[model samples]
Target chain A: MNVLYFAWVRERIGVPSESVETQAATVNDLVEELRAREDRYAAAFADTSALRVAVDQELTDFDAPLAGVKEVAFFPPMTGG
Target chain B: MRIIVQEAPFDFGQQAQAFASGRQNMGAIVTFTGVVRDDASGALTAMEIEHYPGMTEAALTAIANDACARWSLGDVLILHRYGRLTPGEMIMMVATAARHRRDAFEAAEFLMDYLKSRAPFWKREVTAEGASWVAAKDEDEAALDRW
Candidate 1:
């Protein structure tokens, strides 16, 4: 799976995107896997409530199933207009 | 319906004029433009906008389509820009055409409300002091409850 980050989350993670090999079945499980990788990942995933997730480029909750998902993005709430 | 997401600046006046042209059947046309604004200190140098590559267009199109279904709209146009932009520069614009003024105006407002929070775009304000991401406002989210 390809994990992507944006804005401050990108800055904190230190990279925009990365490919990960995981056995995670849900977005929260993936977050847990990433969080165990390093301090930066832990910090970024520390507060899931402060973050938003998208599975396969569609906005969804962290509990969303990741079984056929190709891309997952994590970012702060959008401030567009 | 037309949706445009680009890195380059757009000509709002020309686009608005073109969107309203040749619509003899439509009685009303409403257009709204969003501009980058400086902070209260007036030290803003630029606003950097970031968006998801493939999802931005899809999200905007879905919002426009929903507006069309809810309102009796004849046409809709949405143009949003990304990347670095200076203060006072146009950030985005939405134009709606309908047979009645109320439909056009309300549809435009609905588009703006959704665009403000639902879009995948993120904005950061740059100043001499530093750069900071613009946090989503609670009111912007609450504005969606009306529709």
Candidate 2:
């Protein structure tokens, strides 16, 4: 699956996107998997409240099922106008 | 419906004129422009807007579609720019046309409120103090409740 980070999350993770080979079943599971990878991931995933998630480009909750999901994006709350 | 997500600067006057013209069926057209503003410290150098390439277009289209469904709109136009922009530069614009002024105005406000929180765009304020992400306000999320 392709995992993307945006804005400060991208800065903290030091990359915009990456291919993650995971056996996670849910978004939270995926976050935990990433958090266990390194310090940067841990720091970025430290607080899920400050972040928003999208699965296959649709806004969803952290506990959303990841079945058949090809992409996931994590970013701070949108500030668009 | 016209949705444009580009990095180029748009001519507000020309765009507004084009949207209003040829809409004899519609009696009212409402257009709103958002401009970048300097930080309170007065050290804003530039504002950088980052957005999900594919998802941004999809999101805006969905919002415009919903607005059309909720109102008696003749047409809708959304133009948002990404990349670095200076203070006072136009960041984005939304226009709606309807047979009545109330519908046009309400639909335009609906578009603005939804785009403020739901769109996949993030704004970064670059100032002499340093660059920082603009925090999403609780009021922005609450604004959606009116609709």
Candidate 3:
């Protein structure tokens, strides 16, 4: 699966995109895996309220199922125009 | 519908006309432009905006779709610039077209509110003292909750 980040989320994570091999069954579970990677990941996911998640281009809850999902993206509340 | 993320400046009057032209069904067109400001009261030297490539577009696309679902809109345009920007320069634009004035107005408002609170872009201001990342505004998030 491909994981993506945006804005300061990308900066904190230090990479824009990465292919992840994970056994997590849900988006929340996947976040747990990422959080365990390093302090930066932990900081990014430190407060779920500051972030929003999308699955395969659709805005979804963090608890959304990841079954057969091809892409998952994490970003801050949009500051764009 | 068009969504542009660029550092180049844009012409609002031209873009609005293009969005409404040839669409007889569109009775109302509401547009909003966000410009760079000297937030620090002349203390800031420069402002630089940054965005994530793939994720930024995807996020904006989702936001545009959501606005479409909530309003009877004919068309919408979103333009946000990245890189260095100065006061008085246009930073972003959101335009909505609809059959009625209310829809166009509401959709345009919804798009701006969502963009301010949801889009994935950050600004770092270089001040006379030092450079610092601008924090997201709580009032912007509160504005979204009103709708």
CAPRI-style docking class of model 3 based on DockQ: medium
In terms of TM-score, how similar is model 1 to the real structure?
0.98
Query: What lDDT score is found at residue B33 in candidate 3?
Result: 90
Q: Residue A77 of candidate 3: its Cα lDDT?
A: 63
Alpha-carbon runs more than 4 Å astray in model 1: none
TM-score for each of the candidates: 0.98, 0.98, 0.81
Candidate by candidate, in order, the iRMS in Å equals 0.6, 0.4, 2.6
Model 1: how far residue A60 lies from native, Å: 0.8
Candidate 2 lDDT: 0.96
Error of 3 at B123 (Å): 3.3
Q: Any residue pairs clashing in model 2, and if so which?
A: none
Give the alpha carbon lDDT tens digit for every residue of B14-113 in model 3: 9878877898888898888988788657776777887766656877887899989999999889989999887778888888899999999988888888
* lDDT of candidate 1 over A1-81, digit per residue (tens): 999999999999999999999889999999999999999999998999999998888899989999888999999999989
DockQ of each: 0.90, 0.91, 0.50
Give the Å error, residue A4, model 2.
0.6
State the weakest 10-residue window (summed lDDT) of model 2 chain A: A17-26
TM-score of chain A of each: 0.98, 0.99, 0.95
Evaluated on chain B only, what are the TM-scores of all the candidate structures, in order?
Answer: 0.98, 0.98, 0.93
- For residues A46-67, write the lDDT of model 2, one tens digit per residue: 9999999999998999999998
